[model samples]
Target chain A: MDELSLLRRIRSEVDGPERAALDRGRAALLERAGAEAGIDARAGQGVRGTRVRGMGPDAAAAVAKRRHPVRWVGLGALGAGVLTVALVATNVLGFAGWRGGAEPAAADALQAAALAAVENSDPVVAPGQYLLVETDAVYGNTTNTEAGDYVSYLTINRDKLYVPADRSDDWVWVRSFREPYASFNAEGEALAQKSYDEEVAEADGVPELLRAPDAQFYGNSTVPDFDALPRDPQQLLNYIYKVTAGGGNSADGAALGWIADTLRTGVAPADVRAALYEAAAGIPGVEITEQVANLEGSTGISIGRVESADNSRQDLIIDTQTGALIGERRVELTDEGWGFPAGTTTGFTAVRTSVVDSAPEGGTQNGQFDREGCVDKGNGNFQC
Target chain B: MSTDNEIIERSLHSAGAFAEVFDRHARTVHRYAARRLDAGAADDVMSETFLVAFERRAAFDGSADALPWLLGIATNLIKKHARLEARAWKGLVASDLGRVDIDAIEQAAARLDASATARRIGGALRRLPAGDRDALLLYAWGDLDYEGVASALGVPVGTVRSRLNRARRTLRIAIDPGAARDEEVDHGRIVSASPDSL
Candidate 1:
């Protein structure tokens, strides 16, 4: 059949809005229309947020959450104005058409990984069990001194998140940090050592544990509905493009990074993971960067996209055999920006997820987990 | 039986008169919004579209039919949640199996093919450029003609035609790759030849 008729037939399946929805909309409209006409709309209404602007209650509740800036892990606020990248590096118009000149190797590998994900079932977190995710990461930490020169070093972070199957139950998080190595010269090394010493001293007697009491499916408010995510590969890519719009140097790079970040949570269901892999296959410039990649001992194939702006590449390593995201890494392709040599690993994270019976003790006992304003860092520290 | 222009004009003086416009077109606006986003978001969009239209009723362009203008407003509102709309389309593409309505024998044929065709169309719709997608959807789902689409998108009639052509061409390719590849290639040469001629 022709495309237009096909589209019509497809859309014909969508039932119109329910009567209640129409009534709610009409009521809201009438309330506002009345108020604007100098009529009082406040008769018999017990107490509600002033609908002077006609905002529904849900919109009102979403306002606070929406005001909090959306943060993508591992990709801090990337400034704009780097719009011109290779056609393959941006998802704006590239790869929108059927695989027009995109590397086939990456797409093939990702498709295979997606199929593997569907075959392997997700770990069922039965009632009374906690899904424990342990992650170890190394990130570049830099601090500028009064003298104008900056000291750069790699900081090591290790954290374990214990999420009960019952979302309302208490969730525990424990984290620890240590400096592994400092690069960029003698002065940078000395400064890194000093900073680490101070952090250790300050954290003395401060337990690196936090507890969230009765969090409604922790991170639901922050994380979009994973189950509701589009499962089709092309549509999933479109969805990712929408979420990661204007995020990083390259939109495609940011999307790949976001997938790695979401997977690092270790909470995404198997179907979502499969969809994510399938979606990643649709991104241009996503290629098998490494055939046999090893991160912290675990081995997997590394799929990566290079950011043309900074000459850095973000790599997500996936075990094609099992469809598991083993690790993620950022490699500085050139020394132009960070003065790091080519192939220098600027940052990397290794993830391990398992179901645990209990959470470790010594956290802030019964500290109510605050979802407003503070982010639920898998690492115990909640950065506001 | 007052014209939409008359209702909107009178709504300026009598605020309650605006409800007539809502009563007349709320279902249409809601359906269009539901087609773009989900029903949940459609409620907000429907209510807010009317609210915006009511607040700006003084600016009504005195058309007999307010659907084009109302849809224009709705298109803008839908742009804000373009991501969610794409997700919704993706959802349709991913799960379109048991939703087909097979009532009769002829429809059964279409119904059997509906699942695959729906997925292909859904994928094509999401991938179309936002402007092209909007124009095509306004034409297809909103049941707007060329002039009506132009009015809704606030674009020239020629632009709407060209966008529909481009969008339909893409969808055509997605639905029947073997057949449309030659057409796309021929069109590509013509497009590239224009630069050379210049």
Candidate 2:
């Protein structure tokens, strides 16, 4: 080989150490860059600055507060309280000397009224008229676009008088679903409302994708354009509350109050709780066996029944105030095609729904109700 | 008790400790970059190279040294900023113009053997295709191995070898056309085959 060719071969051989060195150098440089970028690489390392660049300080603080152990413990305690109530309501505790098969006076009265409502299929608004309606009716499967099949479930709730501005008196129906682990504001009130219209608007020019069978669409798409519908203020309020609650937890007294004030032009706690319970009972697979004597002081409700399709027994604990469902444990026999041969325990928390109710007065309003009323001040007003 | 791996692990986890890595390898990287681009461009390129390497540090395999990886990132960045590199070369050539003198030329000629060696190396490099030229320079001047050149070019080891071989052949012709003939004979002997007797 020529002297230069020989030299080149030698050079190639010598380059390995140099290449390794360069690799080492680059790795070190990247570590420094990560540190400068404010990413915590080491476990158990807290972020040094209170503020991060793109996201503000408050957002960072919120993340830290959400991750705190003490907060999680408090939520756990709340879950335990709801569980206790569920056990008591299901008569698992047997505390009130209430035994089975006597046809309790409360059940007899509610059953008779419920059966009458189902037969009439007309709205009833009496103060003590609680109805439990069961139907084989089909509900819109938000997840399945192609599998549009009806499922059987029970419905319960109070019927109220609705007097829209442009229509005659009509019965406005309201119901609440149980949601567990719902987020609340500092004042212990649920923040269930979507604060802005833009928050729900899809970006322009993006085609909507088909939802999977297991996925749910919880945005503005599910809400009805009630403003265009002619109805009384009370009817509008009931419709608005039903639409806002979105088949989720309606147990939050504040959420109920907001609905009451928005549609009825008034806020009543007793009416709100009654509406919430009705909504909870309307959910598919939900069955209300008995109404406890004092619902106001009750933390939550427990229901036991065989699920309609699978005939599997399930127990559910629902938060009474927040309408949040918790501690849902289902046990199935006969090896149904679904996995969980041993059955499964699931914990569910309520996610904030993206739908927001526009103020009836053509301005923005907070979707939450405090103690006083709807709290609709003007445009862009949010409950503190 | 800190082992080598422990030190490296600690350095990987902490950015402040990376200075030790820099203090150890920066001079060599600076020199390599200086050879590829001008000093000013090299500084910026080196900084950026390290910055990118730092950002992707989690992907590092701790068993290996990290210098070649840094150089690979630096090489890519240099390619991205090609115009800056051209300007740096232009400036280098322009500065050479100011130092040109008749006496200096005579003195340089008097040192023909040494000048010839440098010119031959440079001419061999310049004759190579841009890709091979880069591979050759990184290997010869930067002292990177075949694997290092492959890493820098993001190519395979065999490709590096082929490029290096082609570069050396081109260099031999440029340095002395007669030398090419000698190389063909030597290659034939080494491979146990005649050039035309295949």
**C-alpha lDDT of residue A143 in model 1:** 43
Residue-by-residue lDDT tens digits, candidate 1, A1-384? 466666665556567766556656666665554333211121111001111112333332222221111223222222222332323343344334454412699878888888898898778789888988787776664443455333456656676778789766777777564555647777667865775676456456343565664422234332345766777766666556555544544567657767776676666788888888877776778888999999889999999887776577888899999998898888778764223457778677788889877777655432223422345554333333
Cα lDDT tens digits for candidate 2, A255-374: 222221222211112233233234223233345432431122333344434443333444333443343322222334343322223232211111111111211121111111211132
What is the Cα-based TM-score of model 2?
Answer: 0.32
Candidate 1 off by > 4 Å: A1-102, A182-184, A205-207, A213-224, A337-339, A362-384, B1-198
Best candidate according to TM-score: 1
Regions more than 4 Å wrong, model 2 = A1-384, B1-8, B81-108, B111-124, B182-198
Question: Evaluated on chain B only, what are the TM-scores of all the candidate structures, in order?
Answer: 0.82, 0.69
DockQ per candidate: 0.20, 0.07
Where is the poorest 10-residue window by lDDT in model 2 chain B? B92-101
Q: Reference contacts recovered by each candidate, as fractions?
A: 0.56, 0.12
Clashes of each: 0, 41
lDDT score at residue A75, model 2, on the 0-100 scale: 14
